[model samples]
Target: MIPAHEKSETHSKIDPDLNSKGVDEEGETTDHNLTYYQQMQEASLEQLAEHRALLQIFNLHQAGRIEEKWKENESLVVWLGMQIAILKRDFTEYSNCPAHEYNGENRETDEFDEEKELNELHKKVLELTKLRLLELGMFDDFPSKFELVETSRPSKNTINKRFNKLLRKIPSELFPSIRELKFKNYIQSILDGIKKITIGHKIYYNQVTADLEEKGKLKFDYLFQTIEFLLRDHFISENDLKTLFQEDHILRIFSIYFFHSSQQGFSSMVKQLTPSFITDQCFWKFGFSFSQVLDEKDKVRMNFELLIAHLFFNGNRLRGFQEWDSFEKSFGRKKYLDHLKNPDRLKLSTSLQVEGKEEVPPLSLIGTDQEFSGDVNNLVKLFLATLNGPKKTRALSGLVCELLDFINSNISPGILDRSFKKLGSSKNLRLQFDLILIPTRINYSMAVAMEFHDIAERNGLSLAPKVMESIFISYQDRVISLNKELIKVYSQFKNRYGSLSSWLKQNPEYSKINEKSLNQWLKAMSIIIEECATEAKELDRRIQAAHGTAH
Candidate 1:
């Protein structure tokens, strides 16, 4: 019998038969196939997310950018150990496959030496994700079967005191080396091979919005120039950017976009361009043998696909390399984009007069076939998807930086522009967005539970279990309402773009859009990280404090 915990992943057009059965491990038949689709999608998402994280580590190593100090990081060592003893103790009987197969014996390297290298790989991926996906292994949710869990969790104190299992990292050999990997060609085929997509299924195009030779020119230039422009003056120095982002890191990010676009003459040739783990996972289909799982007529499905595409693919959209990528790559829930700006109206208004240029070189606005605004809203969506995905929060944090770049990038000196910002938010981000936004039921949920936990810890008061449960229900409602409010606000803001005429585009909505927008964005972020969902009110100011972040 497949154990209840056995992971299954499925991503495809919904079987036209809702009459299809959804079966559980106990051989019980209950709901429709969508239930099973979600379950399998979620299981596959976990595999994809883990695969993506490991892939990024290899990418960092090849790029020679994994930090040297990661070699013996203790947190990493602890993170990469044997499987959780409790699971081995109890659930082993339920698992058909081991959480991981251990083969330390007869390997070329000593177990200690191999552990050390893997520790370093774990650390680098954590840092890499601190900028890109959900912080993995060392922080947030471990890719391991046991997640740290979502809201209303026991205080880190209570859980640590009870279950201090010394888990071992699985052998690295369980995974395929970059060369041995079989997913890339499949992804390219999705992009390069044009199936007979009808109107409702216009997710992929032959040129991929252009042609290969231009291989993501519009989005690439947009991200590069946007990063340079944002960091160029108000945020950091060119010298600092070089030090903060090495050539390999920057160039690879560029190539990620480059290969996915239609570069005029090189359209077909660009298919041969090396794909990154980011690209791979974003478009990853777990041997189901399909590039995309989309239905244009399904508005909800279209929304998921479009949002994923706009946020991760097309061009880096609002995402850019940041100063935080240099130091804040751990999986902590500290507000990642705090420096992007404080959302307090007065502070934001004062802070956002960041640009000094008057007639800057025309910004790259790639208006190919389809374009829409509200790039930043999708980071929140991406964040939501990561928890649900099997998507990682890694890109959520990094994309938060880019969202700031989108929000704070200039239309004219001293006035920030929202109307003109366009990276099209898809293609690679789209491909990955396409891949990642599977909206598998999130493995976890957070809210009032953590708040009560924090309240108990801060005040040193012990309440009865029933009392906490009652309070938990009450606070959860408010948190849910606040989430609705945020969605409503986003709807209003998005509609503003409908009438965003040439003048609105030229003048920009610095006052209209900046303060409330950042405030809502930051507040929502405060709520839904892997660690816990925060109470949204006043959270814009206390993003880090609420998360109990040490650094």
Candidate 2:
């Protein structure tokens, strides 16, 4: 800690500088105080010899001279004396005393002629101090080294054991077939996502984060599909792929996959790959020479079409909505259109409707598997509207109309209101059911929309009711199972009470209690539970009838 006197002196120094600059002593005018704080910090750090020693040690270690200086002596006796002299001189110079003082005797002049003597003394002291500083090596140009303990490197066996431990954390299931087939070569390539290179068949992952790869296997399913697409497009050949796998040259494959993944369109892949190999050269059998680069618009259409095809027909995973079993059901039922109320909608004669003859198909099957036999002009108009229109309801209405046409169902506002009433008229239950209805409605809506487009007669002969039953089983089963559990718990509570009325009568001492309201609520819940059980049983019956399965 600095002394109070020294702090006063520091304040006085700051006042002079502030007064000279016409700034306030409080420093309110300045927006930044960082400079003042930084100077104080620097001074504090400099005054501490230990801090300087630590800095010097760090420098020496970085320069690879730590081992050489690890045994050097660091005695500070000589430095201590020099520091004391410097402090004494500074204190004397700054003291509030006259330069000269009369000796304790009668004299010719009141002031003694000791000014020159004091100057001579000061000069001699300064010279002596300089000599001492040099002798003590106080301002020597060389950096001081600190004595640090030497550490030994781990033995090869120890290193091997640690490396094996890290490798064991990764599961074998996540390993590629190439990794499984070629152990030695696979070890050289990047198994984990740690960014490093192999030099002369030695793996060198970043030592700073070597254990990062042990966290878990990252999902690269998207990258895998992209690889498959490239192979199909002949952008990469089968033989080359096999060679990469055999040699464990995964980096090359990664290079191409990431490049294509980040780019906009499939034509970009062709443009990018063309430069890597000759089109008309020896490896021309993959149809590289004659392939034309698609324009941006065409590429978008083709890729979008491919995306829809993969998602609906080829059973590809949808990005975020992969969790719901209903999503899987929707994808699986793409083959069974036996339930369509309007089967003629599947045989899209034209994309438009003739005024007197027929009504237009509600859902425009833009990326259907077969060529769109619809009117191209109307299709273009709808496409443009979908792309540029501000209202999503226009698109949504089309989907709803299509679904209604398929399910042979109609929505009446009265019916919906009545159905909601059955959930419960109480505010709390209404709110709960409202929340549950959001997801339920979404599931049902999506199921109808997807199942309507099942033009492929892939699944065997099944009736309309059976198709609806299949689409609804996952959702209904979940609701039934949940409600059944709730009923079981509530039944246990009722059994414990002997009856709700008995429990309510017993608790009448509580003034806030409304026994009548409680009885009504309990009775309503029992009815609700009974209805749920009945609905569940009906769903089970439908499921059984559809699949021809026993309970």
Local distance difference test values of all predictions, in order: 0.28, 0.28
- lDDT tens per residue, model 2, 1-551: 11212222222222212322223333322222234433433443333333223223234443234222221211222222323333343434323233221243343242233323333333433332322222223222222211111122233343334334423433333234323534323322322211121111121122232211110111121223223322322223333333333222243223222222222122222221211111111111111211112222222222222222222321222223222123334332222222122334544523332343222233333232122222122222332232223343122222222221222211111122223233444233223222232323333332322222231122211112333334344334443444444344345444443433353344332112233653453454344345445645665565556456332
RMSD of each: 23.0, 36.8
- In TM-score terms, candidate 1 sits at 0.20
The digit string of per-residue lDDT tens for model 1 on 459-533 reads: 323222333344445444544554454345445435444432332354231112244544553454344331232
Candidate 1 deviant stretches above 4 angstroms: 1-116, 119-150, 165-338, 345-551
